[model samples]
Target: MTTSASPSPVLSPEHLARAYSYSAYRQLITTLMAEGKTTGTTQSEALTAYAQLNIQRMERLDKQVQVQPELLAAVQGLQQRYVWLVLTEGWCGDAAQIVPVLEKIAQASQGRITTHYLLRDENLDLMDRYLTNGGRSIPKLIVLRADTLHEVAQWGPRPAAAQELFQAMKAAGATHEEFAEKLHGWYAKDKTHHTQQELLRLINEMS
Candidate 1:
């Protein structure tokens, strides 16, 4: 007799409850900044400084990032609800650059999409499952069907072009400061275009 395979596990309600909503996540960062701290188990002055800069990045993106017209239209047309569970840390520069844009897309979805932010260090099991090149990367978006909580799609860390640049920099053995400056410079110039295009394609494919 033939047997069907078991369904994959879903995030438990208790775990979901522990995840912060976008606004709550922002508030948490704000509070941490006031205390000269940041998300994650290990904290240091450098991390705290990074967190402060990230706060500025996020705030700017929150006010400046706009969903492309095509992307906005696609999100409005989504037939099924989705949950965007994002793994992030306040001190992560890339997360600060991307998460606000995600919030914008979710907001433009007209209640079709809900987003939750979970600290990566606190959710190692989940992060481990979605590692990028065996590294636990922040701002990893796991798109899940709302009804079944089954993962439908995932995107992360950075857009294709940005990822390519990152890989190149790492392979060349660029220092953290050097690569970071270049990466954020690229982000500043690209202004989330590649990110939106990629998400738009993912949404179209899933739809």
Candidate 2:
């Protein structure tokens, strides 16, 4: 008989954000990679070995991810302050692709919204709260009213159009490698437009 692990207790958003910010999370990954440490997940060695490469991919995205002028203008008009809290792990491929764009968007908001990151493995309690289809999918974005701590809206791991393509490919029997290659290629061609457009929509609705 196997004993299941207990669930992590939920923690306050402020508490978790204070303990882990986006910059801090990046630093943690950098240090881990420097020391040749494995990824902070319970995944197999093959997946863990890709941590350094994922970090590199994230770095590349940070350098290249751009915010469209229209998206910038829309986010700048946000009259209310919000906190963009993200739950992710460095080893997550989706996160490597998406987090940089989110950071750019938050920065473009020009302090109207601040961004923070919480490691998913370390914050299972919070991750459990925002599960995608009973699974712990990463890059979960939680937008909260800064003053009230009320959740305004949320977005996730990937954009709607991208997710649709992914589901369709999977349904059509695309293997994991093929799916990853195609999805990333799509993102490359997309140049963050889908993510930005969707974010604009979310902002418009929340505002």
Candidate 3:
């Protein structure tokens, strides 16, 4: 007799219910910053400061970042609906840089796509499933079928070139500040082109 393969793990409705909308996530960070706090269990002045900086970064990107025409066309053409559940934290520099762009794409989809945000520290079980290099990474996008919530595709942490630059910096033993500076610099110069291109590829594969 033939046997069927086990189905892939799916995100439960309860978790999805608890997840934040992009606007809510941004407001949460802003409100927390006013209170000298940040998301996650561990609280620190440093993390709070990072959250404050991230608020500004996200705000700027929300206004400045533009979704490419081709990517917009592809997303708009998708016949299937998707839910982009993102793992992130307010204090994460990479998340601050990238989440706004994801929001823009979702907006352009005009109901074909919906995006949700869940703090990495609070969603260890989900985060554990999508670990990057065996470590929990923020701004990881888990694309799911809107009907069943079964994950269809995933992208994360950073784009290919950014990831490569990150590994190189790590290999060279660059400090957090050093690597962060170079990474954000890369993002600024790249103008979300790489991220959009990668997402476009993922969308094409899905279609």
Q: Give the clashing residue pairs of candidate 1, or none.
A: none
Give candidate 3 misplaced runs (Cα > 4 Å).
1-9
lDDT (CA) for every model shown?
0.89, 0.78, 0.87
TM-score attained by model 1? 0.95
Poorest 10 consecutive residues by lDDT, candidate 2: 1-10
Which model scores highest in TM-score? Answer: 1
Task: Give the lDDT of residue 184 in candidate 3.
Answer: 91
82-172, model 3: which lDDT tens digit per residue? 8888999999999999999999999999899998899888889888987888999778988888887777888888999999999999999
Count of backbone clashes for each model?
Answer: 0, 0, 0
- In model 3, which residue pairs have backbone atoms overlapping below 3 Å? none
| Residue 88 error, candidate 2, Å | 0.6
Candidate 2 per-residue C-alpha lDDT over 157-193 given as tens digits, one digit per residue, 9 for 90 to 100: 7998888888899799999778878888988898888
Candidate 1 lDDT by residue in tens digits, 91-122: 99999989999999999999999998999999
